[model samples]
Target: MSTTRTHPVAGRATEVPPRSRTSPPSRRRSSRTRDRLAAAAFLTPLLAYLALFYAFPLFRNLDLSVRGYTVRNFVQGGAPFIGFDNYVKVFTSQTFVPALTHTAVFTLVSIAFQFAVGLALAVFFHSSFRLSATLRALFLVPWLLPLIVSASTWSWMLNSDSGVVNSLLRAVGVDPVNWLTDPNMALVSVLVANIWIGIPFNLVILYSGLQNIPKDLYEAAALDGATAWQTFWRVTFPLLRPVSAIVILLGLVYTLKVFDIIWIMTRGGPAGSSTTLATWTYQLGFGSLLPNFGPAAAVGNILIVLALLAGLAYIRLQRRQEA
Candidate 1:
């Protein structure tokens, strides 16, 4: 071959160019950027909504708590910037302490009953039985019903006169106690109504969790000579832990803020015995035939702090589990 010898450039003569480390890494970086942008685009509306509605109102409420103006006008005495006087009142007021105690007892009892009953129902519906689909839909009806209507219906049912509960009690040869009127019974009445309302929600969530469980896990457990209880505790319960956490957290939050049922059922009545933080706040600030905003704001502020703490705890727990 007739040779064409072109001399290499001076600096490059003895050394070849190192490979450029840019294109693939640059493409990967661009891909990641696009993914993050896509994710942010999806999240934009939710963030905007929270900022506008929840965050703004929360700050406004915090502002109301510290504003020293409301005390300038209490009828019994002037509202003072007693810095946290409102909170102090919430703890010490005869009504507040008992009401809080009642709320704690009510929430614990009702949640336990609802969870047990709901879990049973979920098991019932998890089977491939006739009307399973129809039954699942039926179970959620209580959840779908309007709150006021449910409360009203429950009130009517528990009425001392002309109500189903009383009629049944009479049939059982027990006196038709003042289910809603008696101070001893009113909180229980409220608890009953709450349980009725809460059951459907628990059923839905637990049932959904049951459905998400893999069939193969159960099959494997069975093949290992495991009893049903063993399989459930070892496999099913472990799998259900995340969903159960969600259910418990939400149940506490909802139960703590519960108002409509108690409000309609008892109106915080029979001596303000059945009041919760939410209802007490309403009574203090706005539930009066004439409203007082300062203490009400204070009560509301306490609830906000508690709920915020609960939410933060949940977030931390979730992060720890994820990590």
Candidate 2:
């Protein structure tokens, strides 16, 4: 496939080979195929992890909720399908209202106090004093401690009789308060411990957010003679909105599922006075000799729905802000 052509200027014959029209398109197609294969290779592990850990467990939980599972049937694998009867039982139970109320109160109060204290500490440390870093590290002890250790420590510290808290109160000429034994105070006791454990996390996050804010804004506010409170409200809080949103959202999810701390401290005790949906779920599932697996699954599903709704609400709020 050669052709003779005349060179325009030299008036000489030259052999010009013909070009293949299909070469570039075939190379492009091959490159695209390789790129797709590489992308698939990169995504395989993550996909596999989600499928194995998340998707399968969620599906299994859903299946458990729909079936009338008992100890005998749970192992033998012949539980009868019971539609939404478990959910109905959970809804009609006397414990449901109290558990829901406790969960709401515990989650909200804990978040509020945690955020307030953490933000105050973050602002304090942002000023860069000589001992700021050391003190900040000290504050992280609560957050870094193992949950079991933290719960046990709080339990001992809030003991009805010989606790340090009661001793201090007595020294101050105040009556010794029964922190754990009193049903009215049990939730408060756990809430205080939870708040303490959560504060450092919020401080760390908010401090990072504060660091990202432009220093010039603070300088400008100072030059304009704005008070500390004014500067925080105007210059700091607005800039910190995104971090705050994420912190609150994550805290909500974590608090909703909190069982170990409450369980370890009080076993949701004092006749189920401090029981939350999380603890109630355990009580229904495994805390008794005769376990109600389906009802437990339903309670867990309700928690999942609440968390999902909160996530959707956050997304909607973010969209509105962005718009």
Candidate 3:
């Protein structure tokens, strides 16, 4: 005899179907597929963008760096495969070492001063005061101005004889200084301009970081009889570190590929005193009377490698810090 099951509905007796063991697994499988499809749908645009913009350019540059590509070859779209020859040429070039040296100096000095001044300003502006808002807004002038415009303005202002700076110095009974004309000072001048431009960016970022710190921490430090300096060193410094790391890493990357300021201000002038890797690459590719695209691409690849290493270091450091 077959058994029947009664469901509580109007006192009715109904037969129920047996449950299948395969149903749960099949449902889970369908759910997982739906999740995967959703994830892919969300990721598709970003992946497409990376492939088109970043991956494509990187591979193209790598290809160009390996081959004997030149302006003629660029027009003709054909070059002989000459592996590592271009890199050898770039390494052997007379300007490479000096350009590398200048790049290091510029990046280091600019980062130091920019961070110091920016941190000081950030700390100061973190307090509420009259005209503080206006001052902060005005401080963004250098950051907001176009690179070409800033370069031109500074170039004119640093003029040996006719500049306002020289005029002010003369008024103060000081002799005129050669800002951009002298090779010794051209790099210094460029560094100053870059530092000025970078300061506001650092200030904004650091200030935001400062604002994010809890007031309770500061109060607790005060309760522990910590003076302002001690509090900063003990509490503020440690907390600010992550932001500082991010800022410095970003500054390093931006400074590494700096091209506009040097290009506009001096054109690597006073005998290439201000030329960095970026300018050197530009010089090789287009600034030269005869463009050597292969060596230029090789130099660019070198820069890309350095940047990639920096990014990797940052990632590792961040992960360690999080841990």
Candidate 4:
């Protein structure tokens, strides 16, 4: 396209090229296409990772649970599909009740003590004092250490003979109680180790939560003559509810699937006393010469279901709080 104009100095008509109307829209379309390409490029790796690591494993486990997979069958690739027999077998097994009870006790007790001790430590560290930073760092040693090392150390410390704990007991003129060997105390010993390891996590999280609280709230509480206990219950705790909820939820999930600590410490110990679902799954799958892969997968699925339920409950609670 062209246009005509009168040249001011020359007093003659001039011609100019017209702008294309389609260019801007075309550029915009190209920009959108590039954006879409970049987005897909970023998303492809994440999608592949999820498919490979999470989705496929979940599908495989579900398949294994429904099929009767012996060693021979697993390799041969023709495991007989047995429907829900594996789940039924797991439900009817003699160890089922004991394992459930132990799991419940271990998880509940660990979460309770860990949260309590961690909250106390968090509050204590919240007050500015000498060496507080050092002390808090020291507290994180357990959390920072490898789980295997922590569990191994606990095992050594809690050994029935020639261990530091028993030597201390003898010094105090008390009987050397069997910490790990005794069936009754095996779970307790593991719980103690787990609690110690978990406290630092709670402390870090709760301390961060405390840092988010407004100082004015505490000042107001003091101005109103509220005692520390009253102020904590009324203000600090209420303010900390969200952090506490997440900490508890995460703790629940972590504790439920705790395998390495328990396995290393007790090997689900004396007379199968400390066996939780996590250890039981391993035991069923690989502990014996004749592995029951189907039953193991079934147990794993049960744990998945429990974790899913807890997540759902947490989501529901969060929604209610938001509402």
Candidate 5:
């Protein structure tokens, strides 16, 4: 009788509204939103840094490219609005074509030498041999060495006289050649140094790629009566496709932009034979008496365009790999 006196809603267990079931989903959405906000906050500094350092400098360089009616005056900070004259100077100058050709040659030769040496080193170190790890660690030391020290060492070794390399050559009854003095050989000498520096990096990256390959693939191939060469070609090569593309592309871009080795070894010397586009730009921008900044900036812009193209290509390759 007392229960019957209660309201219908109070008498029955209260039926929760169907919308209440969505509360947990709302909370989860809020959590996801908070996480996204936190991630954006974390990324803000990096974005800001790129905008400030990279974007700002690029614009400033471009501004310099279009300014100053004559190359003679920017050295003194006078005049403005020159149109494309400086760019034309860079394109029409005698040094420009040779610098372009030399840079292209340097990139090709260095990439080839680096790939060959690095592949050999990577394969050698990949073997299950004692001291392999230690040798790898030693190899990386060259890359880890300070750039100035590396360049200085090469400069001394390639010195015409009183250098150990020349002394060794002389002792072997070979002529003591002017490694840096001969314009023909100066670029080659710089290439040698750069190749030495590059080999370790290629070795590291390629070795990592080789390691990531499942051993089972080799084993399965072996069971199928496949030769080691066949296994590498079929299984290893296919597996390493992505890594190989990355190595080649990155190497191309890096070798194309090389400046330090040329700078420190020969200082783009021996009648400017060793001067690549980058070194030539440096010469025009700051090294020469006239200091043609606008033309130098134009050359720099060309390099940046190449770098951007390489970057975009890499991105496409990576996307394809991921897909």
Candidate 6:
């Protein structure tokens, strides 16, 4: 005899249909297709932007770098294909070595001092105190102002003759020092200005990172009889590494491309003492009557490489921390 099975519904037995093995896979495939379409729709704008603004410009610049692009090319709408001749010219140029060295020094010194000052301020503000918020807001003024304005203000302050810095030094019985005129001092002056502008950015980021850290960790450190400095080094600093790495990488990229402060203060002057690769590119492209667009593009590509390496480093660090 054959047996029959039924499912109960509303206190009555009803015949039920057998399950189909094919249904679930078909449903899942449709759901996945819908999800993929949704994702692609959301990402389309951003992808388009990157392709239009970033990727296209980068490739166009690369093409220009390999060709004899110049002001004449701008007029005639045609450029000769030179195939890395611009790169050769840039490497062989007298300004290349000094500009490269200045770029390195400026980036390193600005990042180091900015991080140190910013970290100190972040730690100080991390503790509850009166007027702390007000003070921190005040600190942001330098960073908040437009770069041109900040650079101009610094130029006035650091003026060799009648500037406030010189006035103060004179009042203290020291002879007025040439901050912008001396080749030895121009780069240092630019560094000082850049550091000042950069500190608030670092402080804001580091302070936010400090806030995210668990209070329980500090309590645990205290229970372990760790001194404040020991607790900071062992507990806080280690936890802060990821944020610090990000901050440093961002700072490095910003510093590498710094132009406004140096340009306003000295125009990379005093015998090209403060000329970074960025400014050198500017000089090649616009400073002279004959614009060397090819070499300028080559220099720009060099900066892009450095930035890309820094970005890669940041990605690697993040992955390692996640692992």
Q: How are the candidates ranked when ordered by lDDT, highest leading?
A: 4, 2, 6, 3, 5, 1
Alpha-carbon TM-score of each model against the true structure: 0.81, 0.93, 0.91, 0.95, 0.86, 0.91
Q: Which scores greater on lDDT, model 5 or model 6?
A: 6
Candidate 3 lDDT over 61-150, as tens digits, reads: 999899997677888887999999999999998999999999999999999999999999999999899999999999999999998999
Q: Candidates sorted by TM-score, descending order?
A: 4, 2, 6, 3, 5, 1
For residues 64-127, write the lDDT of model 5, one tens digit per residue. Answer: 8888625556546676888898889999999998899889888988988888788778867777
lDDT of model 2 at residue 191? 98
Query: In model 5, where do residues sit more than 4 Å from their true spots?
Result: 1-33, 69-79, 316-323
Best by lDDT: 4
- Between prediction 2 and prediction 3, which has the larger lDDT? 2
TM-score of 5: 0.86
**Error of model 5, residue 185, in angstroms:** 0.6
Error of 2 at 106 (Å): 0.5
Inter-residue clash pairs, candidate 4: none
Model 5 global lDDT (CA atoms, 0 to 1) = 0.86
> Could you tell me the lDDT of residue 181 within candidate 5?
94
What do the candidate models score in CA lDDT, each in turn?
A: 0.82, 0.94, 0.92, 0.96, 0.86, 0.93
Output the better candidate (4/5) by lDDT.
Answer: 4
Among all windows of 10 consecutive residues in model 6, the one with the lowest summed lDDT is: 1-10
Residue 216 displacement in candidate 3 (angstroms): 1.5
Instruction: Write candidate 1's Cα lDDT for 1-323 as tens digits.
Output: 23334446653334345667679989999999999999999999999999999999888666556544343454454445556655666677788777778778877888888888888888788879888899889888989999999999999998999999889989999888898899999999999889988999989999899999999988998999999788878997788878877887788778888988999999988887787888988887776566657567877877777777778888888899889
Against the true structure, candidate 4 reaches a TM-score of 0.95
Q: Which pairs clash in model 2?
A: none
The residue-level lDDT of candidate 5 at 74 comes to: 51
